[model samples]
Target: MYDIKALYEATSVDDACRLLKEHPGSQVIAGGSDVLVQIREGKRAGKELVSIYMLDELRGICLDAEDNIRIGSLTSFSHITKNPIIQKYINVLGEAVDQIGGPQIRNIGTIGGNTCNGVTSADSASTLFAWDAQVEIAGEGYRRVVPINEFYIKAGTVALEEGEIQTAIIIPKKAYEGYKGHYIKYAMREAMDIATTGCSVNVKLSADKKTFEDVRIAYGVAGPIPMRVPTAENFIRGKEVNDENMEAFAEKVLEDINPRDSWRASKAFRCHIGVVMAKRACEKAVKQAGGDVDDRTEL
Candidate 1:
């Protein structure tokens, strides 16, 4: 059981920030999906919870005047899966969040909690990394935005400050413009199982749609944080979207990922699956980008 604690329901973003500033030991809760489990298992220390579930300001999905898609931190996985804006702009993200958990978990689990939880197995992390997403943080008197790639410091840790709360996630227009992407998760079971390894690939094709103008590849459970394979991406960029080049790209992934042995899988097994998932995700992304790889030569 969780220890006794005081519960404060925050009515707005400002109220949540103020409560966090006032109570240094307090923890913020939106969906209580991750924090509650941690508290009951004695993994999280704080007993005071500042609930932001009632703060409607931190919920929704919309495009700002700047053309960046801004998703409020409290936006639930279920909402994300159904948001037309998300499906139209970055459907791969929708695909990633849709596989998070069972119906109940997805209905109440906030994207902020999943990102902030900072686990390598977080299904949303790799996709956000691939999309080059940015996180908007709010505190008592200041606000800042940072690239999602820089958000995670290590496993179960993030760059969030003492009293700052993530307000929204912003996907810059450049990240998703003319891009088609795909996400794939490998696990022992289809649902309710943590990812053994997951991969996401976003490819922006050339005008002719036969070459990869730009590519971003990210993997989950491949390291302490969501793994973005720059070496692999660099190898694939500007290359013809064919089976041979894709195989080379997948092999290059070994130069970046640093998986570890754990109860869920061995390091070697994780690395193997990471490479396999990368190739599969890239193929799917190519298909989504309106390219057919079946006609290409096998390497």
Candidate 2:
């Protein structure tokens, strides 16, 4: 059985923040998919937990007055995958989260927990990075926003301050408009296996749909944190969509990733697969954006 000191049920967002502030060292629990497993594994065995699962304010998807897509932290993977806003605009994010575990896990696994756990192999992390998402946080009487890049401090770590909880994930209008994206999760098995490497790429074609106006490529399990290769993105920003440009862009990613040798896969294997995923994901993303790229070319 899992060991825990106590559980405090929070009734609202303010209540949750108050509980977090009042009970120092208490861990926040929402959707328990990650926390419960950690507790059972003895990773968080004796810690006090404050449950925010019932906080309705932290659960919805909407577009704010600024035209940013605001996704509540408590939104489930299943809910995000089926949301019309996600399907229409940033479908790559939806597709990425959908590949997370099985149906039951997706139903209860929240995007907040998935992100806050700070696992590099998380399915949603890469896409969020690629989309230039922002993390909105609330603590006591203050709220702040952090870019996705700065939000991730390192492997299994985020930039959350004491008593602060992530309230929403915001995808700004400028980040998603005119962009088409794709996600590829390379895993040992197709069903419920975790990703050995996950790649997310998005492209915004020029008005004529002939050249790339912008590109973003990110990878999970590629380094200490899910990160985008700005060097590669810069190289392909104004380049014509073609086999040569795609290959070069994929090669550039190798300079940024520092995957290590692990039981699941070796460092060399992860690097090679990461490049292939990048190329393929970019090609698919370009196609979805109505840009012509030679898909028959092999790396």
The candidate that wins on TM-score is 2
Ten contiguous residues minimizing lDDT sum, candidate 2: 290-299
lDDT of 2 by residue, 7-52 (tens): 9998877788898889899999999988899899999989999999
Quote model 1's TM-score. 0.96
Candidate 1 lDDT tens digits, 1-299: 77637889887777888998888888898899888888888877558899999888889999999899999999999999999999999999999999998999999999999999889999999999999999999987788999998899988889888878999999999999999998988888989989988899999999887899999999999989997999999999999988889988988999999899988899999888777778888888888889877633211
Against the reference, the lDDT scores of all candidates come to 0.90, 0.91
- In order of appearance, the predictions have TM-scores of 0.96, 0.97
As a TM-score, model 2 comes out at: 0.97
Model 2, residue 93: what's the lDDT?
89
